[model samples]
Target: MTPSVERVAAAAGAWLDQAQRPMVLGLCGSQGSGKSTLANALKAQLEKDGRRAAILSLDDLYLGRSARAALARGVHPLFATRGVPGTHDAARGIALLDAIRAGQPVILPRFDKARDEPAPQGDEVPGRIDLLIFEGWCVGARAQDDAALACPVNALERDEDPDGIWRGHVNALLAGPYADLFARIDRLALLAAPGFAVVRGWRGQQEDELRARVSRGEAQGTQVMDEAGLDRFVQHYERLTRHILAEMPGCADLVLNLAPDRSLKEKP
Candidate 1:
């Protein structure tokens, strides 16, 4: 296994060894900081050691396009573009965790980015999961100060949300339901990218991989983003991602500082 995977797996194994009941491990990272890679590795290694584990991705909890359209009408126009805090169904995420802790069989949610909606079917986790790897770009993000929301972080905010209503709304959701959902985590780990500049490149590479998958008939193509679209889409996440980078490492249970190439910068 890779160094990053090994480190995360070791930490997760230690957590499971001491956990009496099912536990939720939140893995937070930038858009392409390898959160999914580490989450899957932890699950595989845990299972190899004879424990049952499942992954619950925050991406899967995204509100469908229609729901987001309603959010846009009721909240901010920026809600129509996903990836921010208010765009996810935090109540559903909380209920999923609640069921897991209750020793119940669970249906894991999945999102279809190409269709901009939840998938028609979800994977099932039966017989009580020993560990739940809840991974996402902003899995355990905290809201920024109201003062922080007054400034635009990028062109997307400056040009479209000049009054800061959209970002303010996102911060409000983070401080409310999202905070409650994240508080359920038994342990939290961070995969810290070197900086947001590297993050943009990482996210662009993900889009490239998706495009390749689409060409091979492995993924749907309808919502595939071109370079320009990807650039703008990533900007939607910049402010909060920057906040997490600056704020989370100080408090996260495990912090894996990543190099620009996405390799571990130091031992955890």
Candidate 2:
């Protein structure tokens, strides 16, 4: 395991040690910052130590493509693309957390990014879990101030959402259902990338890996993007990603600062 994985696992292990009931650990990071990687590693470590652990990625909870299309028609065009608040099934996430906490059997949803929708099947946890790692790009994010919403953070916002409707709607969702969902986390950890400037390179690496997986028949999906398409897709996440980086560090229970290359720059 990497140092980040070890560090997070150590923290999560400690959290589980003292918990009176099932615990939820929220892991937040920007796109391609390895939130999923760390969560999987931590889950492995937990199970090795005789704990029942599971991971629920926020990405997998995204509303279906058709749902997002309706959102675009009714709300904003940007909703047609996932990655921001209002794109996920926050109620489902909350219910999963609740069920796990109550020692109930629960089914976990999975999103097939290749097809841009939910997978045909889901992961069913037949029994209660001791720890749940809820990881995502904006898992524990908060809504930005209305004043901050007035300014366009990127070309996507300035040109397409010039009226601020899309971002405003996203912000409202963050302050509402998203807030309630995040509140259930027993502890929150952050994999802090150096800055948003490095996100494209990290995200591009993910796409490259996904493309390779598809070619090898190990994964399914034709949603891979070339440079230009990828750049535009990255724009969909830039605003709130920047916002999370700026604010999450100070408040996150554990913040692991990373270098541009995704290595630890400083210990948590």
Candidate 3:
């Protein structure tokens, strides 16, 4: 097994062993930061250990294109892109998580990237889970004390702006809709990397692969972030990305660095 995967699994095992309640291990990272890759590895490891493991993904909570478009009309235009905090149905997500944690069956939303929205909402975890590795693109990201958390400020509100001020709407979402669920996490793991620059190229490769799949009708036409679009897309993730790398080390019991090649290194 990969070192990062092994390490993640060990952490999950420890949480399951120690916590009297159901264990929720939060794995948070950027788009190409390898959170999903690590979660899959850990899931395999847990199953091998004869423990029921579930990967509860936030991507599955994505709203339909129509819903996202409606949200963007009132908030920042970036929300329509589907990477921002408002793109998810946070209330439903919290309810589903709570139900699962309370030992009840819950259906998860099925997401289709090619269609650029959530598919049917009938997706459900098939079995009881001893441990849940819940993860998201912007998961475990905090916006407090960061200038980038501002919202309705248009996508151009950056350091170069004349006022250099950011609004608080986006941060409010982090503090509001997402906060309650964040409180339920038992442990967090982060994969540190350089900065948004690293994500541009990686996201480009992802979009290229996605575009080809879309052409064959095998994948939905999820928004494509090409060279320039990716640069812009990275901007939306920058502020939260900074917090995830900066704060997650202190908050997470384990931090791993994943290279572009998917090779691993432990955070020093």
TM-score of each: 0.96, 0.96, 0.87
Q: What are the runs in model 1 whose C-alpha is more than 4 Å off?
A: none
lDDT of residue 237 for candidate 1: 91
lDDT digits (tens) for residues 3-81 of candidate 3: 8888788878877888675567788877777788788888899999988777878888887889988876776555677
lDDT of each: 0.90, 0.90, 0.72
Which residue pairs does candidate 3 place in steric collision? 114-220, 114-221, 115-220, 150-167
- Best candidate, TM-score: 1
- lDDT by residue for model 2 (145-230), tens: 99999989888899999999999999999999999999999899998888899999999999999889889988864767899999
Please list the residue runs of candidate 3 whose C-alpha ends up more than 4 Å from where it truly belongs after superposition.
146-155, 159-167, 212-217, 220-223
